[model samples]
Target: MNLATSPATQTAPATLTDFFLKWEKSQPEKIYLRQPVGDAFIDYTWAEVGQQARRMATYLQSLGLPHGSNIGLVSKNCAHWLIADLAIFFSGHVSVPFYATLNAGQIQQVMEHSGCQALFVGKLDDNPNRWAGMKPGVPAGVNLIGFPDYAAINDADLVPWDHIMATCDPLQAVYQPQPDDLYTIIYTSGTTGNPKGVMIDYRAVAEAVSHTSVIMKHNTPNARFFSYLPLCHVAERNVVQATSLATGGTVYFAESLETFAKNLAVAKPTHFLAVPRIWTKFQLGILAKMPQKKLDLFLKIPILSGIVKKKIREGLGLNEAVLILTGAAPMPKSLILWFRRLGIIIQEAYGMTENLGAVSMMPTNDIRDGSVGKVYPGMAVKIDPQTGEILTKSGWLMRGYYKEPTLTASVLQDGWLATGDVGTLDKDGYLTITGRVKEMYKTAKGEYIAPSQIEFGFADNMFVEQICVAGQHLPQPLALIVLSDMGRQAERIAVERSLEDTINALNPKLHNYERVRKVVIVRDPWTVDNNLMTPTMKIKRNVIEARYDAQLQPWYENDEVIIWE
Candidate 1:
């Protein structure tokens, strides 16, 4: 069944700027964006936000930037990110969002490549001096706008955000954006190589807003959004900002990592979307409150099960969620089933930066194990019979990589985007992503191993947080494991024993060639700061391999099943 062909049709705003104006006109007094500031939420009404955006637009216009000029946005997820994005688009310039976690060198690379005429900096770490070297990367005479709490940089053209909003008059004449006008150039947080800018137009943005709002039930005024993920990614941009704009919903901003849970509880968003890492953390949070064994025993009691589920949902700040989604990586079925028992059905989705983050979504009632549901309406997806690669085509696909027509052609062949992900489509059109074609490797024995499959096999192990299977040119696969906080606190001997038992039980179910031989307990957890993971929380295999391949030789030869790094 085509999920996209539903009878209900949502009317999308002509342009993002038009949507902002419409909401300002219809719901002037409604709270559009709520930002947490020192134990209180500073609410910005639609009228207020629109006013600031207009003032920003006026300021942007006064700079005399060329039409379609790229203006870089460097910041973590915050209320101002949306304001900057709206302002950029409204002023007829393209917004270029860079991952906030990127260092000065990385930021320079992106800024140079995108040819940003001006850069807006917001909410950097406590110290701004870390990016001292980044100043040279900005072209001569480029403008710099710094938001509140921003670290002071030694740039002559710095413009304070407060001054712009307070002194600048509201733009009287708004630039009307064409449906095909460039909206934003989103840089992919690639695990390897320089980031590629994906060109998303106003039409794609409009369609995404229309479809996602309908799919996630974001039509009501009470629909709340908690924006914590980096706004640079298409997922957060489409789901949080665009959906809120299209539906006229309320959005709350997370203050910091320490306040994420509190912020979530306060927002109680009806629609929540996150990557698998966050979902795993939520599961861990629940398990911390109620031991797994005790919860399992209570679930067996018919009457107590419902009560337990309710408590779990409310405790995790998910009781109000109507549609929950997990994407950017494959979530384990075991993990999904565990949440299902608690009445939280996390729908896994499939998409890429090229496709704006959701080609398929697991239908609420039709979810099946190991499938990323079916393709959305108006999108076509099929697997390459020979290569098993997932390919998709739709009106909403990205225009192409900026300034790289050859590279774009390599991926966007004919009409379909070659997804690089190898997967199989079931008879019912459900897709099960097997692995990335580039990530598959062969051992010295000439046996091919798909690390993702091996990683998924270990997903149910509560003691493990992140696992990566590596065995390139080796006799057997090796598991690079990062133990969870609970696992780290357990007695070393106990955790090792449990892991050994886990491997022993799992080995019998796997082919001899696919069985993991040993495990390396990595001392330091992989993080974006360490350059071991992408901002989206996926481990960078190339970075990992380069960092630990030498140690692999010793770990591979070790007699122990689990070795401490």
Candidate 2:
């Protein structure tokens, strides 16, 4: 059975700029963004943000670019990132955002593919390899505008943000976008091959924010948000940027990775969203300071439970968090339960770039572990019986993949999006993702196995930081694991024993062919810098499999249950 259809398609759509204008007029002095600078925060009121955006818009128009041109934005999360996006909209241009962690080759591919006439460079890491490497990627003719010089970025040759505001007057009339006008192009962080640009229009954004505001319970004004994730990502764009505009909420930016904790404490966000990896790191950090045995014991006492839970909440800067969300990748059920013990309910959400990141979200009142909640109020979802692939449809679905009509036609069939994810919808309407349709592999016995299903079984084992099951053409699948900090510090014998116990507990539940033959613990961790993982922190399964292909056969033939690489 399919979920309910959204009523938003019949209503007059309101663009993001409409919401921004509403707040700017209603509460001009209200702080809309808090940007961290050193130890202090520089607050930008609704009026101030509007003025800066208008000024930038005017400067953009002065460059003689055609209306509705595509402009590129690359930066880590910052207040100016939103401002740049707003400026792109104000100038009647489509904003194309690139992941800040992307290297020169990747950046060039996207910039050229998107046909960006100009590029805005904002706050990035101090590493020369990052900022310096990006410089060579910009095409020779594309105009460059630098947001106030931060980190290692040199703006001497580019137009300075401060100079533009000083010299140019705010645009007298902002460009008004129609419902069908293209708004932004969000490129997917492809696990394999080149990224595809997802084209979204103003109408789609309106539908997304309208439904998301109600589903996420962000209807009230003055909500607080912390922005750290890449705004380029569809999830972060909707949750932090679009939601703020929809609710007139305040958004705070993290200064850097080193100061993320300190900045989070300052913001005390009312609604928080993080990926599963971040949640895991938080759990590991807590266990590092206070042993799990002690934490579990403290919670058994009524009085100490309150004190301990409150202290932990305050320490994690989630003291005021009313809604906590995790998504982008599947979260382990064990990890969710672990947080529940501390009185923190983490709601898992499911979405993709094609849908503007609005799909299924776990409800606060009725959360089912291992399920990504029910479909959004206006969306419909169903499982394709043949492929076991999840299909969803909503008004917020993307226009199509930019400049890739054949690819677009392949995924968008009639009105339904053929989400490549495999999932099951329960009687209660909750969706449990099983695996990706493209991620399935065949063993030498010609039986197919979904690696995600196997890897998820190992999530409860803290010793395993990251695991990928791979064994194409092999007799049985092999598990490749990267040891976590806790695992590395523990005695080798203990680590081996823990892994063996996990294997014993999990193997019985799997099919004979799907069972893992051995566990290979690799020394190097998968990271974005190494290209073994995406910027969003999802492991690159194909890359990992190819990297250790030769070892797979050798490891499968080994006698020991655990093999060190």
Candidate 3:
């Protein structure tokens, strides 16, 4: 809503490769990327990264691939991931990224759907089961290029990473990408069904990069970012990779989950972004060291509170952070407020794959607790008169779904795309998301229910790791909860009693249709490997409901307040 705008530099780079070249010319010796090897980090200068990417691009060109061909990239976050992406673009190919956690079937579906002529493999994930499914799914006639680490996948056409880098010289062809040129096809990590490819062009990327630079106040090259989130997601693609190229900022990659905390400390990034799940883990880690009551008492004091906050921030490796961002899922307001007490104000953002993840974000200086800031400049937002759904149009919006014009037309209409989120804007233009349009369900009594609101209502209960409220056609809604490690280790009866008390406390705040009448303590938590969550960690409600479908009728009929499943 027209806050004091700190717009990004108008003289942004023409293209991603153009920025790489610009930085290489101006600041060739500056450390642009860092990847942890063993006990130490390996740094790459701007010139070094440019040279490696050029070699990779030359290798792709030597393969006799036609211009504008599709290339698939399958890997976790790493320095090579960025290099491979730049190589693909430099060689005039469109990069199609497959999530590292995708199963073989999903991988096959994406590769075949995108018509990828070649696939690049980097440090694969640890889950052997997911790899097993992926190994056999490589399409016939598609060339395979492996990273240096070479996680074993028995491919006959595999070309080693070292061979490409050592054999191929730097690319000499002076290729340039137009603003309207298709850059990449980012598939949506659908929570309910198959993923859809979102076609993003150079224009959209430029627009998003410029806006992000302004929002982050990344006018200088000193902005440091720790890249741990899945690089395949639009959030990471735009924020870390695109923004780094735009601003000449440095990027540090996390080696693995074990090294995440240590890596964060090493990088001491100036800007940080995380999902709600990661934030919860951080809170839990702090609580393990000190009780909440003790923490509250310390925060109540004056000078001690400031010292404690500084110490806590330093310990968590966020002491240098200028902005902390939370998105990809709804964060509980209670959780946000709790972090504020520790002298951290998390700015929640709202956007999706279709919009290049730049719709609205809370400004750093003026943040409201429950709102996700105002509509960004050069973007128009409105609500559907009938459905009350959020609609937006922006310069960075995707062109359309790849080869799925009918599906694209369903969402994008008359210069505006339905956001599929139910939300309201305050008079000051601050947006508060209510729930997902597709997530609303009606009970047998013809009462509508918004599960996310109820789920977040009980999120303050520390013992709960995750909660999903479902009813469908049932008479009443029920919550399927997975306990935190502390809750699981505690005595079962005590955990159940605490849960019942929490339910009793939350019920009075809900409408008749929104009350959670029953609670099921699930034995196992929902995970990406289990096909119950997207790579971004959003729960697949249909999958979860199907897993417990047989027991739902019985649970609905039973009179127990807390049902142990």
Best by TM-score: 2
TM-score of 3: 0.96
Output the worst ten-in-a-row residue range by lDDT, candidate 3: 1-10
Q: What does candidate 1's lDDT look like per residue over 441-487, in tens digits?
A: 99888988889988887888888998889879788999999999889
TM-score of 1: 0.95
Per-model TM-score on C-alpha atoms:
0.95, 0.98, 0.96
lDDT, residue 562, candidate 1? 94
Please list all clashing residue pairs in model 1, or write none if there are none.
4-377
User: On lDDT, who's better, 2 or 3?
Assistant: 2
- The CA-based lDDT of model 1 is what? 0.84
**Can you rank all candidates by TM-score, best first?**
2, 3, 1
The C-alpha lDDT values of all candidates are: 0.84, 0.89, 0.84
Clashing pairs in 3: none
What is the C-alpha lDDT profile of model 3 across 360-410, one tens digit per residue?
888767878777787676666777778878888877889999989999999
